[model samples]
Target: MRLIPNMISSLPSSLLRRAAFVVLIFGGLAACQKNDASAGQVTGTLNDAAQAAGQKLDQAASYVGQQVDATKATAQQNLDSASAPSINIDPAALASSAQANLQNAASTANAQLGKAASITGQGLEAAGRKLQAWSAQNATSSASSSASSSGSSSASADSSDAQKQMDK
Candidate 1:
């Protein structure tokens, strides 16, 4: 009572006026009608929106699960098919074909080796003939240049022996 008035008197007049203004504004706001119906409508709308979102999420999850199951089934089917034998092979026929190819290769190699041997033999024979002719020519020349007939005869005999040995 007296204490409150004494406190108010101790405050500045400008501070008192500001306090009164704040109190009047708050009191006026409190006297206004609050629309409870709109609040309830907003709350209901929020709940409905939340329920719709939840339903959409559930549907999306179901669709994804279905797609995953379908994919798994397709993969399993592919795996099963892959495990089954698709190509037929006959071991006996394959062995017979390989044996024939080996026989043909062996015959071809033998023919080629025989031809090479024949060509080598002919070349060796021709080289031996040429060496013998050259040796005979050298022996004749040396015998003719010797001082004695005996030495020439001996050299001719040696050349003939060498030629005979080469022929054999």
Candidate 2:
């Protein structure tokens, strides 16, 4: 009991406040459970609450660590810049390099576009030939069917005429 108070006093004020808040919340929940819950149920709820609080504290610590690291890096960069020598840049050379890169990209893009167009045209030509062949086949089949139907109708007319002559 004495050690616990000493440890709590050693913690920063902000951390102590946060710890007190977590305790108050879980304590209220435990009090509420004591009214309608078994001892085991209250214990389980406390366990879960403790675990959640621990996870939240861990996350807060990790975030603070990351912020500290970022601040340190920025400070280092500022110090380095203060002591580093100035750099000389040639604008003309930079412009020439940029222009060369742009031209190369444009040439590569044009070549790819040309290849795509050629492939598309070839695909269209093949599709057109297939369509033409299918149309010709359908036309020939329809014409033969029409001729066979006409021949069958003429034979039926001849058979009717022969039946009429026999009745006379």
Candidate 3:
């Protein structure tokens, strides 16, 4: 009879210890999840492209989905004359969002547009970052904005040299 009372008393403490352990485990898991959610984040600036350049880019990009080769000439025109506004980008976030957008697009044509826009935005953003980085390193703002194959490294270097003298 006495032992029964003792066992009952010990039972509550044992249960309490188990409960504390469970709470600790749950809290740890929650914290770990939060940390994971915050990882692989990208930070950057927004793009405010010139109205004309933006419109041309949109048209050319949309056309690309329908006529990849047919837009070649028009794409050149847009790129050649574009004094487009700048759009900054964060590569990590763009990649993740683009991934999600691509998954969503697997169902329909409208989704495909979303996919296209996402892809275009990501590409432009990445290009912008690269251009900005190059300009910063080389002390010049003239990186070829051309989307065509003719944009060569030598041309970029020459342009940078010319821009330096022009800046003076």
Q: Pick the winner on TM-score between candidates 2 and 3.
A: 2
lDDT of 2 by residue, 29-117 (tens): 44443122335644664565556555555554444444344434544454455465694445455344434443443344344334433
Candidate 2 lDDT at 15 equals: 43
Candidate ranking under lDDT, highest first, comes to 2, 1, 3
Worst lDDT 10-window in candidate 1? 1-10
Q: Score each candidate by Cα lDDT.
A: 0.44, 0.46, 0.40
Over the stretch 1-168, how does candidate 3's per-residue lDDT look in tens digits? 133234324433443353345335433432332111112221122222223234533543453334323233333443444434574444455444433433332223244334444554455455446644554544433344331335677667766665664344
- Kindly report which residue stretches of model 2 are placed more than 4 angstroms away from their true locations once superposed: 1-87, 151-168
TM-score of 2: 0.38
Model 1 CA lDDT for position 24: 49
**TM-score per candidate, in order?**
0.39, 0.38, 0.23
- Model 2 lDDT-worst window of ten: 1-10
- Candidate 1 achieves a global lDDT of 0.44
By TM-score, is 1 or 2 better?
Answer: 1
